[model samples]
Target: MYDTILVPTDGSTVAEHAVDHAIDLAETYDATVHALYVVDTSAVDIGLGTEQVDRIRQGKFGDMPELEQRARDATGAVATKAADCGLDVTEAVVGGQPHGQIADYADDHDVDLIVMGSAGRSGVRRALLGSVAERTLRTTRRPVLVVDAETGTGSD
Candidate 1:
């Protein structure tokens, strides 16, 4: 019953698991996979793209280019994997609130399902209760499938 699936990647190992699950779902349903990588502006220091030190010292402000490149790399990897699975894939790099961006993207693209990791790159203690995943579940109108990186158990 799924025509479009979304998978958000932050270049984390947990996210990699999510990618695998998403790809499998796409293959089964013949759905198009959208790989989105968001550059978390909130995590950046001083509201700038640069690190905390650069923001503190006011020395530079060009870290955004590097961050964008990193985001592209992350998305590209997802796209590559999805393509290798013989699934239709669309990939993009965005900067904004992670949960908001993901939810908005789902709405804008009419995504049927979202597959995500239970934990983040920093390794959260709770699965499906992590900040982004929880917020996404609260915000999105579509169904969310959260896969535990350690256990590989998925709950929707």
Candidate 2:
């Protein structure tokens, strides 16, 4: 049913958990998996967040060295996992608000579904910061398969 599946990763253990779900879906539908790493610009106003956003806005993803490494590490992990499962995977790194960026990526790329972790590293901060997966679900029209890393389930 799906031709392209999007999996957003933050290099967290929770995010890695969702990678398994995405790979499974991709294999089922014979779809390609797109691994996206969004550096949340809203989280930090200082170094990488702000700087990377400006570069991304200008369509320059190669200017920031350290941030690029981080993005590579995050997306690369997902790509490697999907590859091991014999799935075709693509990787992308961008800077923006996580939820919005994720939805936009899905729309812009014509993604058929999004499989993401319910909670990431923003554990304690979740109450105050809110959940990225929740926000993406609220904003996107595409089918979202949220993998609950804490419980190892895909329901919620």
Candidate 3:
């Protein structure tokens, strides 16, 4: 039923599981898998102070180039996993609000499905912090399969 499947990875173990599941699905359905890694600007903004933001603006975080490189590496890893499953795969990295970027990418690429991982935070925690998968599910028009990190179960 799916022609193009978009899988967003955050380099987390849960996201890795999601990618694995997406690869299997792609192989079964003969769908093309588009893997995305979003360098969540929000996370960086929260973790780093204003001084760090200024340094980033001045292009001075050379020591942290590995951070961006790691995201690319995660994308490559997911692409490789999909390819190994004999599925067509493409990968990219974007920087922005993770959920917005993912949703916009799905629309821009005409993705039929989105498979993502949830850290499984709930109630007050989820309300206060929010979740990229939850936000994407709420905003996107396409079908979304949210995989729980702990159980690895999804709406599929």
Clashing pairs in 1: none
Local distance difference test, candidate 1: 0.81
Candidates in order, TM-scores: namely 0.82, 0.86, 0.85
- Cα lDDT tens digits for candidate 3, 6-90: 9999778989878877877888889999988876665677778777655544334555788768877888898888887788888
Among all windows of 10 consecutive residues in model 3, the one with the lowest summed lDDT is 53-62
Top lDDT model: 2
Q: Distance from true position, residue 102, model 1, in Å?
A: 0.5
Off by over 4 Å in 2: 47-52, 56-63, 120-127
Candidate 2: Cα lDDT at 26: 94
Best-to-worst ranking by lDDT: 2, 3, 1
Residue-level lDDT tens digits of model 1 in 24-127:
99999999999988666566655343454343233222545676677778888999988998989998766567899899989999999999986633555554
Going through the candidates in order, what is the number of backbone clashes in each? 0, 0, 0
Winner of 2 and 3 under lDDT: 2
lDDT tens digits by residue: candidate 2, 4-97: 9999998888888888888988989989999998877666446656565688644366656776788889899988888988889999987778
Q: Worst ten-residue run, lDDT, model 1?
A: 52-61
- How does candidate 2 score on lDDT? 0.84
> How many residue pairs of model 2 clash at the backbone?
0
